[model samples]
Target chain A: MKDKQNLTGNLGALVKNFSNLHSIEPDSMLDLNTTTFLQKLVSKDVIDAGVRVKPKDYLKSLVLLEYFSGIIEGDYMACKNLAKISEKIRKIEDEEDTSVDPHERDSYLTLPVVIAEAALCANEKEDTYSDNASLKKIKVRYQNHDMKIDLHSPKSKKPEPYYDMIGQMVLDVTSKSVEHYLEKVSSRAELSSLIFTGHALDMIKSDSQKSKVKTALEKKDYFSASLEALKGIMKDITISVIDEYISNLEG
Target chain B: MGKKVVQGGELLFKEDIIIDEEAVRMQLTIPSRIPIFSIDEMQVFYNSHVFTLTKNSSKDAMIKVYTTEYGLNEEKSPKLQEDEYFKANTAEVNKLKEEFIKKAVIGMPDNCYDKSLEKQACLTLVEKINHAYDIAEHSYKAPPSKGLVPKLSDDSIFNTYIGDFERAMLLDGKVYRLETIQEYLSMFQKAIEPKFYKELEKKSVLMTPEEAFKELTDNRHKIHPWGFPFIRNKIWYNEKSFKIFLDGIYWIPKFASTSKNAEEKYRNAIERKIKTDAAEEGFGK
Candidate 1:
């Protein structure tokens, strides 16, 4: 019982601190949803005494487990076909690596929580989209279609840039070319436009943006990086627009 | 946050956690600009490897118990147990790590020998999972496309096996040579008013294929406290991301928009495997 109390206290503190830092209400953030597994662990007598977590309130259990295991750990089934999340913590006894950045490490330990929490809270009902005031959104809302891209890349900055990249055409609509025999070609991946840190292209320049990329990734701020990457993605339009840009130079 | 500790298939989420629709759509958007879910796939990958690692370690523990109880290997030691003597020596094996039971109890009743065995297996999984920190992977992706995402068809099939995304690697550069692209973009080549080639000629050309290829291939992204082991999604969760990645690399090269082709093939393979398994089951019975 004492352990459970400490567990609950520690959990409440962690959730409260996380909520404050992210500006999300504790209720809105990840719920320590322990409806299923812990129910099996705690007997019926405990449940009748009003200790049940209602539903999805695994917060205390999570902390207790972590205290024992040193990370959010479980292989128990909670639902069907869902991604399970666990946060990794550094143990006091282990040797630390000198090569990796601490902040970079922070981003990873928190990625699952960040991804799941972001996904749960992201706007799901928007009809259509554009975020950058500079770019005009030509796409209209489809009750069904507008949310498709948003579901997977919840962290992407805007829908317009993706549309713009898709709008690039390097081939004549009617062509006999073998390359045209393949799919439409855009020279860059959408993420290439993000140039916050040491972007593949940016690293080639005299002033490598390595620190910026490092910082953004370390911060897990792929959304901001996506905005810059959009510019980088669009620059490839010329290379696609002029099919032989690179070969023309070399040839 | 220490060093690369977690590995593929280790990033886990509660089966019940809420996932928003925007997050779902982000990967499945009909026309994606780039690949999605390097992090997700990697987690799945690491999770699988860890499961294997855990299972093997647990089994190894069982083997250790077997060896300790029987004292078989050393010259002139007790001989290997007969097939019928399985139950007699379990008490000896159970005590090896009995105290570990206090920490975790994954409740694998299948391990008939003891709590120690169960504790070791569960702890192995937990330790490996917790050990994962600050992980990321940089997946080299094929170029993006427009209007190429097959118009929503009832027929397009998405495959989620771990190998599916990598099946069609980046387009063979030799195949999409300059002439082929020029032929495809003949209009751009012929545009007199825009003079695409003249403008193209002016931009600082950046073709260092060998360098770019090596650099891009050498580059990768990672997720969480470990390296993602696979680039594919073995479980059902993020089919959309792997589907998009697969399509951009393979389907486009075949000059095909989306089709139910992969779905059909995958379903057929499963069907065959089931039939084969049923026959084997009959044999066992």
Candidate 2:
């Protein structure tokens, strides 16, 4: 919300920048509401960067941004519609010409979260919806929010229309558990312990291994590479920790 | 007299490619559209010897494109010869990269730590990858959230393919310069602090890669993977993008050379993120 505080000052400067960059009239470019909506949806860093990096995709970006805004604002219709669209997009029929790559669809699906994460990271004071607790609350709102879809209605035949509806409900219940499970599983000490075993430690300590880690670090895939290294480490430690922990618990 | 099959070169056009249905489809198919090469057959054509685009001095303003049913000669290729010649020029490219690093590049700024350049580089790299792979394109999509931070002690080769692909793009390019493709990509031995490169010139003490990595990872908690889907503005060579270039230079060992697997893992990770996202949205069922 503090990001909203700079809206008035930032808007004028941003509009000027956008207009200058795109060679468009300032008044013709974006209205106050549209600007505020996008600002609410993403960070100023994204906005400024978007304008500079891919000006051609600006219009399309606006449409996606608005859709995200609607979803975040607790619009069930938006959420339901996006879910349906996502499902349709994801469904790969053998003969379907329009069936996009899984990565592309995934990118579209994860855009909101990615933007939210970026905003959270880029400028914390300015980002509104990135706090984990806040996002959890939004998820709760989507789950508990009133919806008009009735499975018992006469026209609700074949259970097809209610498929996503059912999916929505299932996801709401399952995702919370998934989040909880992930949280419970991510014990720093335990994960570290798995990686610090004799062989794993030797791999980490070896000059070749350090060089390998250094290479991964350079590639910016450092995190996943690190995770992969952890995976390698856990090859020996797999399931052993659970028994050890269980024994500790029993003792 | 026109030659049999034109190989080892591209048809350079003097005019801008007009947008047609074919162009639009090609553009759409590209997933990530760049400034150059809009039309599939008109502006750019590659890898085939049966067709050629050559400079003809006829002033009719109509360019002739030659096509034939001639099968490609695998034993000896003009394109392969061209590639060999290009490969021989690697030293020149390395020199260019070195100069680009020495004079042009800057470290991550201290005050703002403005990462627009780095973010832009990622966007560019992602766009190039998407374009190359024929995947549906969404520019400025953030890298997977799970890989947001660089682990200090974590050493893994499974996720090093992206880096490998990037390195290939930079060093092996015959057409586009790496700096031109993603300006501000650092190719230096050290990841110096902002304006520290200039200081290094004076002091002659460069930070080691490990030290740089430590500095970058030390403040890793502050590092966020924020991005927008429509950043199209010119993000020229800057400190942040340079840092990314610095980060992208890794030697993949033979043991961890499963690039395909790494790429798959990368895709799978994105898919997982999408599921998590879909789960979070709840779809208002």
**lDDT string, candidate 1, A68-109, tens digits:** 111111111211111122121333212245344332332122
lDDT of each: 0.22, 0.27
Work out the TM-score per prediction.
0.16, 0.17
Share of reference contacts kept by candidate 2: 0.00
TM-score of chain A of each: 0.19, 0.19
Q: Write the per-residue lDDT of candidate 2 for residues B17-44, one digit (tens) a residue.
A: 1112221112111112111111111111
For each predicted model, how many residue pairs clash, with residues at least 3 apart or on different chains? 66, 14
What's model 2's overall lDDT?
Answer: 0.27
